[model samples]
Target: MRSITSRRNVIMKAIVVFIITGLLTIPGYTLAGTSNISSNGTPHHPAFVESRDDLVNVQVAHRSSPSHPMAPNTADVNIIELLQQLNEPLILGYLENLTSFGPRETGTPSCDQAAHYIFDTFQNMGLVVRYHNYTDATVSGSNVEATLYGNDTTNIFIICGHYDSVAAGPGADDDGSGVAAVLAAAEIMRNYDFDHTVRFVAFSGEEQGLIGSYHYVQDAYNSNESIVAVLNADMIGFTATGSDGIVGKIFENPASEWIVSFTQDISVIYSDYIGIQLFPQGETWGSDHYYFWEYGYDAVFYHEYHFNDYYHSANDTIDRMNITYSTRFSRLILATLAQMAQQPVQQRPVLEISSISGGLGVTAQINNIGDANASDVKATILITGGLFNLINVQSTSEQTVLNAQGSMQSKAMVFRLGKILITVAADASNADQVTKQATGFLLGPFVLEVVIAP
Candidate 1:
C-alpha cells in the first residue's frame, strides 16, 4: 500500500482499501476471437454492431483473463479510499436536516430552504456554488449546482439528484436519500484532486416531470457546455422488505451503460461489505438523468430496487429508511463519481503505421506512451479503391492493451488493386479515436504517424 497526500492539503480521511478477488461472469455473451478474414479479403463486419450490449460488461468477466480481470489502477484505488470517507452518521444528519424542512415542494418555502441548505453545504466544502432559477406555468424553483474544479475545466461530470419531492409528506425517502448521497459524495471528494471537473447538482421540480434537469440541460446545451456524464441517485434509502433486504437498481441507456457498468464494478471491488445488491436494468424514463439522456448525453439512474410502501407518506421518515443501505448508495455512487473524475497520469496512445507495401497490407503500430495502462485498444483500417469504393478492415492482428511506452503491431488486410489510400484508426479505452492515412504513392516501407495527446 502507498501513502496518499492531497495537493490541497485537505485533511485526508483514513480508510481501509479492500482488495477483492472474484469475478462475475456474464451468462450468454463471449468474445469469440477468429482469423477474421476471407480469401478476397474484405473485413466481415456486421453493420451497427447488432447491439451494444454484446460488447462488454465491466462488472462481470465477459471472458476469462489470466491477469486480474478489471483490476483497479492507482486512481481507482485512491478514489475508492476517498469514497470510503462517507459516513452513515453524516449522511443521516443531512437527511434529518433536509427532512426537517418538510416536503420540499416546488414553489413552496420548504423548497427554497432545501436549496439554500444544499448551497450552504457546498460552500462549506469549499466548492463553487450557484443556483439556477427557472419559471414555468405550474410552478417555479431552483437547481443548486456546486463544482469541484479539476485540472481540466472543459470536461464536466455531474452527480445530480432531486431535492424537491411530490406533495407527499416530508418527502424523506422520495428524494432526501438521493440528496444525501449527492451531498455526501461532494463532501468526501472536496479535498481530493481530480483531472476533470465534477458538479454536485441538487435538482428541484423533478416530481413535476424533471423540470429542473430539463432547464439545466437546455441551458447547458445552448451554451455549448460539455457534460461528460451524469449520475443521478433517487430514493436509495428504502429496502423492499426488511433490514436484511439489500438491493437497488441501476438504470441506464445504451450511451450510459459504460458508467453503469463501471459503477457495478466498484460495488464488487471496493465495498461488498455493505452487503447490498446493485441490480442494473432499464433504458426508460425517470430522474434527472432522463433529461440529460433526452439531450443525447451519457447518463444513468440509481434508485431503490423495490418501491417503498411508505414513500410519499408521512410515515416516510428517517426511521423508515435503512440507514446502512442508504450509506452504501452514497459510498458506491461517490466511488463512481470519483473514479470517473480521476484521470490517471497517462498520455493517450499514439498510432504509427509502418511497412505498407502499397498493394497488399500495412503494419499498424500502437504505443501506450503513457504512465498508466490502456486497455480495450483497437486499430481499424480503411482503404479507398477506384472511384470512392471504401473498404473497412480490422488492423489489429492481436489485442492492443499496452503498458507504458508499450508497442504492438498488426498486419492489416491485403487490399485489392487500384487502392488509393490506407487509413488507420486507433482508440484505447475511454480515449477518442485518432486516424492516420497513407497514400499508395509510397515506394519504401511506408511510415505513418498519429499522436493522440492527453
Candidate 2:
C-alpha cells in the first residue's frame, strides 16, 4: 500500500501549484486508453486516481440532456417538515455503529460485516433492497442498494457513500459520516411519496481505486437507466473550533454545473433551516461521484470546507466529529432531494384516500389535495375472503365533482361473517388512481381488528 503521508504531500503540492499558477485545467482522456495526464502533460490530482488501470475499458458513454430541467424555487413547507425529521441521535448512532467495525478494508471480514449491516438496515426500512456484486483481479465486494420506487420509475436520484475504510482507521469522518447521512435520509424519506425514484447506495472497494462505483456505473449505463442526478457525501462531519462558520464545498464538472446551481439555490432558500453556506468548486475526481461523469451522468460531490487532519488515520473516530454539523448537512441534502422529486407544478387533481373506518359498515374518505377542481370523482370499495368465501361486498361512490382541497365520505358498505380483505380506491378525471387496502375480521356488520397496509 502507498503511504498516506506521501499522498497528502502530493495533494498539498498540487494545491500550491494551482494557487501559484491560477490556471486550472481539465484532466485529459483518450478514447483508446485511460490516462490522467492533461494536454500539457501534467498529471491530475494524484490523491484521487490511484492507478491507470482503474479507468481501463471505460468508454465515454453519451446521454442527451435531462428531460426534467432544474429550476430555482423556494423551499416547500412540506419539505421543511422532512428537514425537521432528520434526527441527530439517529445520525450519531449510525456513525458510532459503523466505526465499531474497525478498519473496513475491501475483501476483509470487517468490510463484509459492514456491508451486511448496511444491507440489513436498508431491509428493515421496508425498501426494495439488493446486493450488486462485482469481482476483479485484485478485490471483490458488493454494493448495497435500497430503492424507494416513485410514480415514475424510470427517473432516478441517488445518494451514496463508500462503506469500506482504509486499513489504518475506523474512518468515522472520512466516510462513516456520509454513510450515516444516506441511511438517515432513507429512513425518513421512505414514509413520504415522490415523483422520481430515490436510491440509497453504500459502496465497497472505493479505496481500491473506485472499483465498486466503476462497475456499478458500468451496469447502469448498459441498462440505460435514466439517472437524473447524484449526491455523494464523502467527509462532512468535522468543523474546527473558532472557525468562521459551517461551509460545505460542492464540487462539480461542466456537465453537472446545473446541479451545483440548483444546490446553491436550495442552500439559499433553506439557509434559515440548515444554517450552512455553500461554495461551488471546480471538478475533482477524488471520490465516488467521478465515475458517473465518465458515464455521461450528472453528479456532485459534497465535502467539508475545513479539512480534517485525522483523515485515514487511527485517530479518526466519533469523538472528533460534530454531530450537529453532520445533521445539518443531511438536512440540506434531504431538502434538495425533496424539491428535485417534487410533483409537477401544473394545477391538476391529486386524489387520495385519506382514511377508512369500520363500525356497522366500512367507510372511506376521499380527498382532492390539488389546486384544480376534480370532475367525475369516483370511489370504490371491494371486500373479499371470509368463512366459506360467502361474505363479499363491492360498492362504488355516487358520481360527484370535488373542488380543490375538497373531501367526500363514501357510503357505508356492510358485510357479514369471517375474516376479510378490504380494498378502497379513489380516482378523478384529471388525476391518477389511488388505492388503500386493509385486512379485518367482520362479525355480522361489526368489523374488528382492522390493519392498514403501507
lDDT of each: 0.66, 0.79
User: Model 2 TM-score?
Assistant: 0.65
lDDT string for model 2 (80-181, tens) is 888888978999999988988999998999999999999999999999999999998768999999999989888888999999888999999879988999
Superposed Cα deviation of residue 96, candidate 2 (Å): 0.9
* Clashes per candidate (backbone, < 3 Å): 0, 0
Task: Go through the candidates in order and give the C-alpha RMSD of each one to the true structure.
Answer: 20.5, 27.1
Listed in order, each prediction's TM-score against the native is 0.61, 0.65
lDDT of 1 by residue, 1-454 (tens): 3345563333322221111111111111112222332211111111212332432222210110011113244345576567557888989999999999987788899889889999999999999999999986656889999999999887788998889876668878778998998998888888888888899999887776677887898788767676777888888888767743567777776546667677777777675544566876756465667667656567888877777778667787888888888898788788777777874422334333333433334665766554456677776655444223333334454464667567766555442333346666666664434456666522212323322211
lDDT of 1: 0.66
Best by TM-score: 2
Residue 411, model 2: lDDT of 53
Worst 10 residues of 1 by lDDT: 60-69
The pairs that clash in candidate 2 are none
